[model samples]
Each structure stands twice: as C-alpha cells, then as structure tokens.
Target: MAPTNNHRTRCGDTRFPRNVILLLVTIFVFLMAAISIAWLVMHPHDPGFAVTSLSVTNFSLSDSQVRGRYEVGLTITNPNKIITQVVLHRQGSLLLYDSELYSKAAVQTTVNLEKLTNKSVKVDFEVKDQHQKVVPPILGRDLNKGVVNFNVVLKVTVRFEAGIWPSKDELLDVTCKDLDLEFHPKTKGTGNLLGIGKNCSTKNAAGRT
Candidate 1:
C-alpha cells in the first residue's frame, strides 16, 4: 500500500506536465533560431552589395620626356560580394593653382561597376596638357604673391555602368615660390585657366551639361 501511494503521488506531480511543456517550447525556439541563423549565413541581400574597399593611389606622371604619353596610374579595390559589369570612365578638367599660365593637365577618377571580393586593379591615365601659343602678359611673374599652383588644364571623363563620378574642376593651388629661382623658372604658360578666388570657374562643376 505504501508503494502504491508513492507511485500515485509521482504520477500526480503537477509540475511534471508544466516542465515537459516548457522543455518542448524551449526546443522549438532553439530550432527556429538555428534555422534563421542558417538562412542568414547562406543567403545574400537582394543586390548583394557592399563597399569592401575605398582608396586612391598609384599616381605617376610620365618620365617627363615622352611627348604625349603622359602616363598616370590609379587603382580601385573591391572585396567579398561580386560587382558585375564594371567599367571606368572619368571626365573633368585640370586647372592651375595660380592665375598665370593656363597649364592644364587632366582631372580624372576611376569607375568600377563590377568587382569581386578582395580584388585590386590598376589604371593608366594619359594626362594631356595642350600647349597654347598665346603668351600671358604676366607669363613669368608670380600671380599669387607667393602662392604656387598648377598652370595647365585637362578635361577628363570617367563613366561606370550608368553613373558618372565627377569632381568640381580642381582648383589645384600649388605654391612654387619656395623653389630656387635657378631650378624653378618663374614663367606662366598660355591657356584659359580657372583661378581660385571667391568666385567660381568653369572647372568646378562635377557634372556639366
């Protein structure tokens, strides 16, 4: 009779049913969490896009002897996800740091619409500085008191996929007065260059019609 009573008490334990239900619910929640985690790991976003890398480097000018082969280099990076149909087409104008010679080089940027994870690329630019025969009144005179700047200009066009990355026509204000008079001759070249004053120049528009 004592054993029988013990068995009945064990079977009637009210906490037993509650504990079993709680365990089942806990297991279901864990299973759901695991499945959700698996989905996130295996599936990518709709576009699967991310900015893995961003930088500007490898800028080189020609050997200074080549006539029109003024070579410039650039690089772009992408990592992880895939960027498809990538291309680069940069467009912009070069400017002088001063107001003397309108020496123009080329303002440019790199474009990559498609890239794979952890990838590096190089770009070669042929920065052309068109020489104008016309001479400026202050050809060699220091136009900016003691400030040095670029004396040339170049228009660049960088196109990637359906977007265009452009820069405000660079107002490259480079000072050259610190250089020795014998080495750095003070002479401004010819060209309609944009000056960096309170006003705006034609080269300041990132996207000009």
Candidate 2:
C-alpha cells in the first residue's frame, strides 16, 4: 500500500499534532516529578536534625543576703539532627534595685549534644553587691535586707557540622541575664522582714478604733 501523507509527515518528523505534543508534555512532567521524589528520598541530609526545644530550669535565691551567691539551672538540648561539637557562651549582668548591689559574669560551655537527643546542663552564678560604695541616707537600709530587683538573661550559639543548625533565644526576665535590679521601695511594696509585722494590728486595736 502506498504510504499516506499523514504517515509520511509523521515519519519525516514534522511538527507533532497538538494532542500528541500535549501527551508528551504530560509524560515529561510526570517523569520529572518522579525524579524529584526519588532524589529527595535518596538524598537525606547528613546532619540528622536541629534543636527541637530549649529552656532554662529555674532561678531561686539560694541565700537571703544580697551579697550571697545565687545559682541558676539551665538546659540546652538537641532534639533533632546530629551535631559534632556545640559550644555555648552565656553572659549575664544584674542591677540591684539598690545601686550598692550588682553582679556580672560571662560563661562558656561545650557539649556533644547528639542528634535526636537532649542534654542537661547547669549554670551557676553568684551576685556580690557589697562593693565599696557610699549609700545615700534616704535610699533606705543597708544592702543586706533592702528591696532588690534582678534579672538574668542567657544567649546560646550552636554550631552544627553533621546535621542541621540551631538557634537559641536569650533568656529574659530570668536571673541568668544579669538584668535584674532592685525595683526600689516605690515599687517593692512593703519592706522585707521589717515591714512584715509593721502593718499588723491586734484585732482588739482595730475594734477600739
């Protein structure tokens, strides 16, 4: 049978029919999608993951004296990818409500916080407000029992070579930041021990009035 013009045109590699071209485009798109999926599945990141969460434990007054030492508990963990070596630096400065009392310190710690894991670390800070400084008479009592305001903040830097990189937040409102300072009598309300019973009046005294 003599070859039809349609067959000759097709065999000659002329412009493809619109429908045929559309079909080819669809197949190519599907193939590209498949390749992408395969690549993604095969090329998983070498470093497993980054930090899932970070937190500080608690800051409590270990002693009553403003010059007394204070300890802060903090934890930094890597919950995701594998990290080779993580070195964290934390610095804190505290301003006591009383100018006489204040503290400041800098600290650095290194850990091998593995991927998909958590590590517990403790940060200890001591505040000594008893530096040689004259106090104004109206400023109130000695540095020992005065009302003191204090805050400590911490910043963490993480380096991840094996897995994913992580970023940490600076702890605010916490004693670790060294931002804490005494709020002064105006804001501290009643005084510490001395002011406790000053307002107390016997029920009898109240009845007489």
Candidate 3:
C-alpha cells in the first residue's frame, strides 16, 4: 500500500489578534488626548512691554557723519504665574525716514523673571562711524519743530517655566512705532524722547518652538 500524505492550511496567520489591535488603538488615542490637554493648559496670555523713557546724548550731524548716543528704558510685566526668561537680542534696526540708520550692536542682558513680577531693563544704543549719506535729508528738515520721528524694531525670545517642564522658547517680533524726540541745547542735542509710552506691540503667533 502507498503511504498517505496530510496537508494543513492556516487561515489569517498574518492578521493581528482582535484584543491586541484594540489595545494599540486605545493607547494611540490616549497619547493624542494627553498632548492636546498639555497644550491647552500651557497656553499663555500676552505679556506687557512698555517703553518708560528714551534719552539721547551727543546727537549731532556734521557734513561728514552722523553721531548719536541713546539709551532706551523698557519695563517688562509678566502676567502668568510661571517664571519666565525674556531675552531681547541684538537683531533689529532703528529706522529714520525708512532709512537704515542704526543696527543692533549689543545683546540685551538676560532677565530672570519671577511669577507675576515686573522687571526693568535698559538698552544703550549709539550710532558712530556711519556715512554722511543719511544726514542731508534730516539736517535740512526743521529741527525746531522739536520732534524727530523714529521707529525701532526688535526680536525677543521668551521662555516659560511651569512646574517641572520648561516650555519651548518663543520668538516675538516687537515693533516700537512713532518714537518722537526733541533736541534741547541744555543737553546739547540730547534729550528724552516723547510718545514712547505703551507704543510697542509684540507678535508671536507665527509659531512656537
């Protein structure tokens, strides 16, 4: 008699078990939910940045060059309960008549903020060794009007610390508009600027990193 052969076929061998598949799906849902909750809880309100004063020293324009020394005072207000670190770096410019008059020359000092605290910072800006090309337009203008209009643009990095997790830093675009100044012979072309009160706006909604 010839030997008999038996063959067995397996069904659905490559498919996952129903229980295992359910477990994986449940885990994915839970992870997504957690991330959503974290974001909602960590969302922060806009902080306050105001220019308290702007002082100028040795503001002069000659036939060859334009020179000026300036100091800008800013007050930072943190409204959140978490600690924050605000960094105003040197990456922007000062504009006069849409002209690039001065560049950011130094990094602003780092600020360590406590919860709901106010911090004051001063930025010193000076323009020297510049060409005379930007002077003719301003010199011919009436300085006796007692006001020169300027605009300042800056980029700041803000970091927040909450509980044990420090949120990723946020880059903010700060623009100070319509900084008007009057030159006085008392300071010999040096005086405090006007219209700098609460004239700054910060935009960070582009994206957070």
Candidate 4:
C-alpha cells in the first residue's frame, strides 16, 4: 500500500506540469490569432503619386555645373477605403540625373488627403550658381541635345488615421522616372516636361512597393 501511494504521488506531479504547459501553449496560440485578425482588419493601403507637369527656367550649364529653377506638379491620391485621412508631413524632393542627385528642395507644407480623394501640389527648386552641382559628362552630353531626362524623387513621412486610431509614421519614397525636359528653341533657357499624367511609383522604407 505504501509503494502504491508513492507511485500515485509521482504520477500526479508529472501530470500537473503537463497540464499547465498545455494550457500556456493554448493561450499563446489564441493570442497570436487575435493579433493577426486585428492586423487584417486594420490594414491600410499606401497612397499614389503622379507627376502632372514639370517646368524648368533659367537653365544653363557652365563648365560642369548646372543651374536651373524647377517646379514639379504632382497629383496625390489616397486609395484606402477605410482610412479616414492620410497626412503627409516633412516632404522633400530630389532631382536626379543618371542616379546622381543634382538638386533638392524642401516642401514646407502638410498635405491632408481624405479617403478616395486627390490633391494637387507643387514643389519648387531654385538651383542657383552657388548651389549648383557639377554635372556628369553624360548629363552634359544630354543637355547639349536640347532634351534632358531626369528622375524626380519625393521623400515624405506619412500617417494614416482611422476613426479614432492613428498609425505610426511611415517613410515613403516616390519616384517618377524618365521625365524628359525639352528646352525651348526660342527661349533657350526654358523647358517643359514632356508626357502627361506620368505615374510615380511609391515604396516604403523597407523597399516594399
């Protein structure tokens, strides 16, 4: 009877630990499932960007340096159906020639976008002689041909607001590629962007599109 009692006690102790472990694992699984469901329900889509127009004035290339005044027009759209508003903050634009940054401008404005709505904004860059960047040989050659192809990149911090919830700030990169600026023959120093409704690609900081 004593041996049987001892054996029963050991069995009880082992069973207790196993039961506790099983309960913990079950709880963990349920918690993870709940978090996943919440994420799916609140997922927000990124906004879209399009280059509506680009204007260049006072353009000149001396030696290897380039100077110009640029105005970039953009159409920003919010495509999310559930998000109440999208706020874009601290925006900046970069002008690139063959992947090299030539000029940059700060957009000191906040953009508020409602759901399924679009807004138009313009970014201005004044590249004076003092702020001009030395152009690459390839860029100089393109300028001689009266048409120059450049890339416009927009960097912005974005936040999405739902009913009462606001998401964390996200950094986004918007790229408009192959923007051809054809210099006017008569004006000599002025040019306009060729192509209409050129769509820009947006990507997150993690390089996800």
Best by lDDT: 4
Q: How do the candidates rank by lDDT, highest first?
A: 4, 3, 2, 1
lDDT tens readout by residue for model 1, 1-209: 35797788887797799899999999999977876675455332111112211112221223221122122222233332433232323432223323232222343333443534322333233434445333233423443343323322223322212122111112222121211111122332211112321111122244322
In order of listing, the candidates' clash counts read 34, 24, 0, 0
Decide which is better by TM-score, 2 or 3. Answer: 3
Please report the TM-score between candidate 3 and the true structure: 0.72
Model 3, stretches more than 4 Å misplaced? 1-36, 62-66, 128-140, 205-209
Summarize candidate 3's per-residue lDDT along 1-209 as a digit string, tens digits.
Answer: 65434322222433447668889999999977876687568776556788778777887766666677778788888888888889888766666666566556465768888888989998876777555564556643745556777677777888887775536578897778778777765556776776546557888858532
lDDT for residue 43 in candidate 2, whole number 0-100: 35
Q: Pick the winner on TM-score between candidates 1 and 2.
A: 2
RMSD of each: 18.6, 17.6, 6.0, 6.0
Which stretches in model 4 have alpha-carbon errors above 4 Å? 1-39, 83-96, 102-106, 128-134
Which candidate model has the greater lDDT, 2 or 3?
A: 3
lDDT for position 123 in model 3: 81
User: What shift in Å separates residue 69 of candidate 1 from its native position after superposition?
Assistant: 3.5
Superposed model 1: Cα runs more than 4 Å off: 1-68, 79-82, 90-93, 98-118, 127-209
TM-score of 2: 0.34
